[model samples]
Target: MASVVLTACQEEEGAEEGETPEVSVVVSLAIFDDFARQLGGDRVDVPTLVPGGADPHTYEPGPSRVAELTKADLVIMNGLGLEAGLEDVIEENTPSSTPIVELAEGLPVIDGNPHLWLDVQNAIAYVEHIHDALVEIDPAGAEAYRANTDRYLAELQALDEEVAAAIDSIPSERRKLVTFHDAFPYLALRYGLEVVSVVVASPGKEPSAKDVANLVDAIVEEDVPAVFKEPQLNARILELAADDAGVEVCTLYSGTLDKKVDTYVKLMRFNAKELARCLG
Candidate 1:
């Protein structure tokens, strides 16, 4: 729980003259990495450990990556047990003096879910936390950071309205969601949709027969038109579940973004459009 204040760059202490020393930040998630990059602008260097379209829940970095992380001034994580596999490596490799900011900390937790960024308001909160951390680490850049945060927050607010309108287009009874895993509870909650069932309790783990059976039953009973599959995960299980329920399987960007859903705002709009098409 170290604050970002511990990440004051050493380069700032001995800079000759007029050189703006960049703060190096190691972010565990791609989305947050992009956020830091956008907000940090020229003042920060963000190297993401998890690559684009990689599953954070099961991603494990090699020794080289670990060494890179050890040298970072700050490490940012989504927290809430999302990066379960990388926890030990992140804990052991990061330098003692470095600070780690968990963006989802202090936010509302529902049913122990960690996908807060799926909710636009929570994503705004993330932007605020990241802005505060960046300003704390480099107090000289506070004004720039505040300005960047304001611009991004405005974009997020507009995207939130877009998501609401898209979801509203779907009939109340049709606004049920079934996904490859429990990835979209926050999205559903925010958009007035219900997550009827998930094909797997956790990604990368095989679903038991009971789990599949229960999900199939729910899908059939709820008349869920489509089951969503994530881009980073294998769609075999979801396809099977959808086939069993006599429904179609659509793609959703749970965590990592692909070429189609590149930025955070684009990711939200893309998912909203898909949900509208499938459920409306």
Candidate 2:
């Protein structure tokens, strides 16, 4: 509800009194919300369901949020189990005519991680699908959506190369990554980094003592340089694993974004740099 109110400011200051309102969109997470805004520009009302710095894995939408979803012209979701907490609400509330598009539909699914956008390649796919959906929903804005998609894809392509090169700079022996959860499989597969082990399988899930023990064994055996913690998840378990393994602990951003790194481009750049710092 707070997120809906925050993004509902579109009606406050603009235009003639009789202009047609933009198509309203409700996105399940912050990243998709940014994607809608960037591609739709002023032609779409994109209200992010999960607020910034929140975990989509555990975010529960309230009644007001369900109402917004019911009235939205489109509901965009990652659809790879990223928003497990909202499944019932989305199924029960979204109108039948409202088109619900899943950005991760055709992408390669990692075993347990649904963070496909972490890979710029997968993000390009997301942009293409979003462009198609936007064009289908708002034919009048087709030209604008195409232009924005082209420009954004170019930027993503450049970011892809930059991430590849930056990750390549790290020696092969140091390319192993250990993080709080299994959120980096796509990233590690896209880059050359190997996921040594993850402390937890998913966000908001606690690891068992046996799981932690096994992770510590892997970390110590692999001599992992660091165990990364995500901003949206509690880092205490990662801290325990790192301490047991005698390695450094660092931070990584996964499902959440802030003012400092709000967009997908900035978020990827920040993550690449942080990984390089930790592993290179």
Candidate 3:
């Protein structure tokens, strides 16, 4: 939720055709960092503020990270509240002339949820935004950025289709989600799955006894075969709830990445397969 407070940086046209511009970029999360890399290729240096396997909802940026931000040619974050921990620090330290772009700024938001990229279509939109931001800062590399963006967009379309097929494999009655946090609404909406229960509304919030009770009840009532716990967020509460409900717990990638899945595309494929295995 940071405003681009500084004056716009001067436009430059230096890189020749077929060569990539070397732009320093600081991204707030790993997923967005991957998106920038997919679009920028070898030209952009995307240093993620939040580390992999860490929950961005509760993550705080440190001094070393601030130093990176200060020198970054472009600063990018997922707006809507994903960078809640880094917003103030970035705004305070970034140069007035550099552009700080929020990848999710212009996309459709659902109930103010910051996990818009969970939907493949929304992720495509984010890549488009990244392309525009890259071009604006490096007009010389516009062709390169556009080519990279188009290629990644096509791959994203294939990913969307693949996810749809995987989800469709599950029986309609079992297409439901019980997750650690309210982070799967967009994904659920995309695949026609319902978010039956969640341990907490957002990261860092403690769940009440009633919340646990309701979650277990919903699991039983909905008859979902398995509940999901994100790799990055603590899921003890969710595990206990699932145990109480007598259903097995499975893994899902939400706000962050881990060893098994390091990139956004891998994360989506992992989710689709896990969902099918756990629910089909």
Q: lDDT per model, in order?
A: 0.86, 0.86, 0.88
Question: Taking the tens digit of each residue's C-alpha lDDT, what string does model 1 give over 162-252?
Answer: 9999999999989999888788989998999998888776777888888888888999999998888989999886788788879988878
Candidate 1 TM-score, C-alpha based: 0.91
Question: Which 10 successive residues of model 1 have the least lDDT summed?
Answer: 1-10
TM-score of each: 0.91, 0.91, 0.92
Residue clash pairs of candidate 2:
none
Using lDDT as the yardstick, the better of models 2 and 3 is 3
List residue ranges in candidate 1 displaced over 4 A: 1-21
Q: Which numbered prediction scores highest in TM-score against the true structure?
A: 3
What is the per-residue lDDT of model 2 for residues 63-102, given as tens digits with 9 covering 90 to 100? 8878898788888998878889988888898899989898
Listed per candidate, the RMSD to the true structure in angstroms reads: 6.4, 7.5, 7.8
Model 2 residue 130 CA deviation in Å: 0.7
Model 3: pairs clashing at backbone N, Cα or C within 3 Å: none
